[model samples]
Target: MEFFVEQNSVVRKIWGKSDTVLFIFAGASAEFALNKAVDWLYFTGKLPSDPLGRLFSTVSYARKIVFSSKDDANKAIDTMRKIHATVEENRGAVIPDWAYRDVLFMLIHYSIASYELLEKKLSDAEKEEVYNVFYRVGRRMGLKDLPISYTEWLPVRETHLQENLQKSHYTSDLFKQYKKHLGPIRFKVLIESQKLVVPSIVKKLLYFGVFSLLTPVIPMYKISRLIKLDWVLKSILLPSDYKAQINELDVHSD
Candidate 1:
């Protein structure tokens, strides 16, 4: 509870507002509605406005849509329709929920593509194509310009970590949940990121006595990913723009 509060509270303090909320729940819930809630609040008038906030808010709204059921999906679609209408009428956007929904869809699709690759699930040509999409999105999201060759992005022959995973184990449960739901390709991404680390065999052996298992990591990953990366991307927007985008998406009559 404390970790959850701290993690969310930090975003609140960073952005400012108790009215600021994200409705992500675990294992089969009405998360699309939560996405809608984010869409509403963000579109309406209560969240940050910047590349980092846009990325975080986008993922926060997207996470649920990725995990939702058909019924939940329909519910989200209905809610999205209303949100779209509201935002269109508002003339302002920050953390634009529409842009978020787009990015969120790409992330889920990429996770699936990653899974197929990890299990040797895709043929060579298919794999190459899937990887291309990954690079395209990475480029779009401002994750450094995508490489000319998609295959190049895979865990290089060199032993390295996924930048997303190599971090402290602060939000272990959230990270664990992400790993569990991420399936294979996404899991492999985690395996290679800063959010997770491959400890030396000797270290693993030494820790085995105390922990008994490889630490499943993701929450910690989020802890790090949330750090503002605008400086690196040199993203060219102001916080107010993102806040305006979110406000424009707001639709809940409340």
Candidate 2:
């Protein structure tokens, strides 16, 4: 009955709530677009073609790993590796190890960022715990040169931000696809949400302004969550088609 993430773990608190998970992807969507290796994502045609579906699919695997037993979580990780291996086989080139690390780093970064944005600040120990979970995932996936601790990871994460991201044609096209899929209103929300969680480098690279529109709205949104009226707001802010999937993001609450 041992879970991949312990029952009382902060990782569960971060990923269990729908709002935090949404913001995690909202931030990740920006970084994913700006990644130097984004063409690898485009190779499958899935990310650009149905970005929201891709988000949910990725979230599904993440939650499976976070919530299941250790054996099941390891199996899910193996499946993900095999899927990428097949993509590499088809494309006839290996995806760079750094690209894999970038993704793992994104999960670690955004998990802390999104949760702190929605809830209170995490202590140093809690932040280290977050890093440890994903560090294990990275090791399982055979990524090399990952920083051994969250403190060590900070500079490495910064280095990756500097060396591994650029505004390519893929960046613009992916943002366009996001806007197309989310529409004007939701896309604006997504951008603002990304502002609240993404790193300074991401903000600078994307030319985001100093302020987010959501800065003032977050307190009000927190109030709405306390009263159980958050879904009403979510309905208005999110597309109707994904409403069910969005609701399902609140796994630990049940």
Candidate 3:
């Protein structure tokens, strides 16, 4: 059975680990708040009301594609497209093509960024491989004007960063929702983690300081992982209600 991502792929290594996946969303949550089309997310009312549940729902679809057979992955992608189409129908406005591309680009960017921050830097070929997997998913969803190669995508991603993001009222409200949901301490950790993975533009727009408090603690966290005590730390840091789902994020092994 051919998998959507090959068994030996670095993409699996990146997404398989719980810490890496958490960081991916940490960066994405910041960018999601800052996106120009964030109102589209607010339209459904699901995102702001239950942001952590939304994170798990999004991660479920992503893992389904990454770990399943090709046919299953395609079905998951089609289901996502249908879900968005239903949302568009209910809202009576077409979501912009660029909005869709911005999301796809976020997955591609954060996948590499999160892994490198927690693990080692990905080589050029490995980064291309990462881009290709998500590119196929975008093609399945009919996203347009995506760059064909990872090298070509860099400038386009930068352009999207510049043209497609702003700090709107939606941004402020979403961050408030995050803080409300995660509480003060976890919220502070989320902000510091986002600082580690997000781009310079995101840092500028979010007014994040250059230094992350988590910087010195990463080595200690890595040691915890090696000693098999990482889950204990994760449980303490994350909310109690999602403990089971957080454990499930470690579904795949390298």
Candidate 4:
């Protein structure tokens, strides 16, 4: 529509006149790449919850390698480590290799979309308006319940994730760290007299033909507590406040 074109043009203009150095260093689609990653992982039933901070933190993982920036690279690694731990704890369902590749593809696609937001016209508000459209793109692609992530406005390929995986100890260390945090008794069943097929009712009597009624809510509460806690903590730790990350840079890259 004409409205979109005009809006996009304005947004691109604003970005063009704003800080160029930060734009390039930040990887134009960095936000998009990371958000898409989280979205896909969540949809595939791989990740438990959606937290804006978690998405942002993961991007730092991708930015450092692609952009050749120490700050971005270190930040990205920190995010990867955090997620690796969570994945191990909740990986009750084994995800296929294709799932990881699919996540990577989402990252790449969003990265490009995000970079487009940085052209010469978008204002801070306009950038938000434009990038939100990408979330729609995810919904159309069968990810029905997508989160409203602003990754479409972020730069992409700013850091290389593949390079970070080169660290031999990264995955194991992350898993160990998160597991320790979780403690050994991550999943414990409260049972009076359990039966096969995970029976809803207990098999034995408590006080000679007497028993306490069990509520499903009790176990669901336990699971929710674990998932929600990690989601909140990760979101807080990732994406380091954007205002602090911003600094002066050259008008253009050669």
Query: For residue 137, what is the lDDT in candidate 4?
Result: 29
Off by over 4 Å in 3: none
Q: Write the per-residue lDDT of candidate 1 for residues 1-254, one digit (tens) a residue.
A: 12211222212221221112211111001122123233443344433223234345544443333234435534554565556566767855434433343333334233333233222244565545444433433443333333455356443311221111222232233345445554555433433331112223212321323331213433332343359432222122123334444443222212
Position 145, candidate 2: lDDT = 94
Please give the ranking of all candidate structures by TM-score, highest first, separated by commas: 3, 2, 4, 1
Q: Which scores higher on lDDT, 1 or 2?
A: 2
Model 3: how far residue 136 lies from native, Å: 0.2
User: lDDT tens digits, residues 1-254, model 3?
Assistant: 98899999999998898899999889989999899998988899999999878867887788889999999999999999999999999999999999999988999999999999889999999999999999999999999898899999999999999999999999999999999999999999999999999999999999999999999999999999999999888988998888888788887865
Q: Kindly report which residue pairs in candidate 2 clash with one another.
A: none
In order, candidate lDDTs are 0.33, 0.92, 0.93, 0.33
**Residue-by-residue lDDT tens digits, candidate 2, 28-94:** 8999999999999899999999988887788778888998898999999999999999999999999
Q: Please give each candidate's TM-score.
A: 0.27, 0.98, 0.98, 0.28
lDDT tens readout by residue for model 4, 98-196: 334334434433333334433223346654544443343233233333335445323321232322122123223323432343334320111211111
TM-score of 1: 0.27
- Number of backbone collisions per candidate: 39, 0, 0, 35
lDDT of 1: 0.33
